[model samples]
Target: MTMSISVNARAWMAAGLVLVMAQASISFAQNSKDPIPPKAPAYFPSVANQYVVRLNHEVPALRTSKAFSGIEDRLGASIKEVLRPDLVLIERRNKETRTSALVSLRKNREVAYADPNYIFQALKAPNDVDYSKLWGMSNVGAMVSTKRGLKGVDISAERAWERTTGSKNVIVAVIDTGIDFTIPDLAPNAWTNEKELGGVAGVDDDGNGYVDDIHGYDFVNNDGDPTDDQGHGSHCAGTIGARGDDGLGVAG
Candidate 1:
C-alpha cells in the first residue's frame, strides 16, 4: 500500500512544530540579571559632591553589633542610596575635594576608601516603548508607489520583529545632524537619559562630565537638546528606528 499527505496537512504539521519551539525559546529567555531594582533613595541626591561605593564584600557581613550601621557621616561619607550589595551611592565631602569618586570599602572598616581609578555620579533609568508604522515592514516587496516606481529595496524587518524589535541596552549614535526629539511623532521614541533629565537642567546628572545631555549633545549650539536645526538628522533617525506600525509615523 502507498500513502500520501495533503498540502494542508503538511502545513499543519509544520505549524505545530513551530508553536512548540517558540514556547520553549520563551522559557529559556526568562533570565534574571539584577534580580530586583533597589528601592528609591530616602533623600534627593546631588551628583556633584556625591560618590558611588562598591566594596569587595557586603556591608552587612562586617558589622559587629546591632548598633553598627553601614556608612556614617564621621567616615566623611553619608549613605544616600544602596544600589546593590557591593555598591552604595553616597554623598562625600572633604577639604579641597568637591567632586565624587568610586570607593571600595575594606573588609573591616566602615570608612570609604576612594579609588583613584573609578569615578561616581547620579543614578539613572531608561524606558523602552515603541509605536510606529512602516508599510515596508510586513511586505517590503511591494512598490514604493509614492515615487511612482516599482522597487523592492526591503530587508524583511517584519520577520526579525518576531524575535526582537530593539533593545534599550544598545545605543545607536547617528553621527549626522541632530534629531528633533521635540516632534510629536518622534517624542516617545526619542532617547533621553532618565538620570540627567531627573537632575537640574544645567547640571550633569550621571557625571561623565557632560551636563544636561538628556537627549544628545549639540556641538554646534554648545548646549544640550540636539534638536534638528538641519532636517538631515531627523530624516535619518526616522529611517533608523521610528517605531513600527504606530499608524502615525514610518516604521523604524
Candidate 2:
C-alpha cells in the first residue's frame, strides 16, 4: 500500500526535500577560502554596534542514497563552522518547546549574520482602520476648474502643506500600507536620497545604520527595507507631495 499525506503534510515534505537539496548545493560550493570577503565596519558607529544571526536547524534525511552520504558530512561541517562563531546557540530541550539564545557581541566586532533577502518577505498586517480620510474634514470648499467650471475640492492637503512644509522638514514617516513606486507622477519625486542604504542581507552592506533602506525605514520590525504592503503609503505620499496644476489627482 502507498502512504498518502494531506496538503499541509505534503508542503512540509516538500520543504524537507528542498532543504536536502540546498544542503547538497552548499556542500558542492564549499572551498578552502571564504566565498565573501570581510566587510568593512559600518560608517555610522552608533548603528554598527549591533547585529543578528539566524542559524539553520533543518536535519538531513538518513537515507542510504549515495548522493545523500556524499554531501552529508560536508553539510554538517559547514553548519558546525557557522555555529562555531562567537555567539550563543539555543538548543531545544523537548520536541515541542520554545528556546531563546541571546548573544551580545562587542561594539568593535560584527555580531550575527542573517540572510538579507529575508527582509523583503515581511508579512503585511491588515489595517482595516481608515484613519487618514476618517479623521480629516471631507467636504471643504470649491475651486475654479478649467474643465468642469467651479467644483468642490478636498483642500485639506493643500492647507496642511502650507502650514507644515515651510516651517519644518516635515519628514512625514509614512508607516502604513504599501505604495506603488512605479507611477510616473509619483516616481520622479519619490523620496530619492543618496544617503539611503541598500542590501540583500547578511552584513550591513551600506553602513547607513539600516540595511536595504533605499527608500525609508520600517520601524515596525526594524531594519530598513521600508517598501509598503498596503496602499496607504502611496496615498499618504500623494497627500504630501502631489504637484499642483498637474491635471491629475488632487494636489497637496
TM-score of 2: 0.32
lDDT of 1 by residue, 1-252 (tens): 111110110111001001101121000111124332332332322245554455444545444533225344434566555555556555565532332233323322643333221221321111113221233433333434455323444444443443345654445565667776755545666666779889987888898676787777776556665767677777656656654443454545
Clashes of 1: 8
User: Model 2, 162: alpha-carbon shift in Å?
Assistant: 6.9
C-alpha TM-score for every candidate: 0.41, 0.32
Q: Please give, for residues 1-252, the per-residue lDDT of candidate 2 as tens digits.
A: 111110110111001001101111111112324343243333312111112233223233443656434333422212222323222122222232111112221121332232111111112111213222312212333222544322234443323332222212223344555445664434544554344433455355667666555555666667455555566676655554433334444333
Candidate 2, which ten residues in sequence have the lowest lDDT sum?
A: 13-22
| Model 1 / residue 125 / CA error / Å | 31
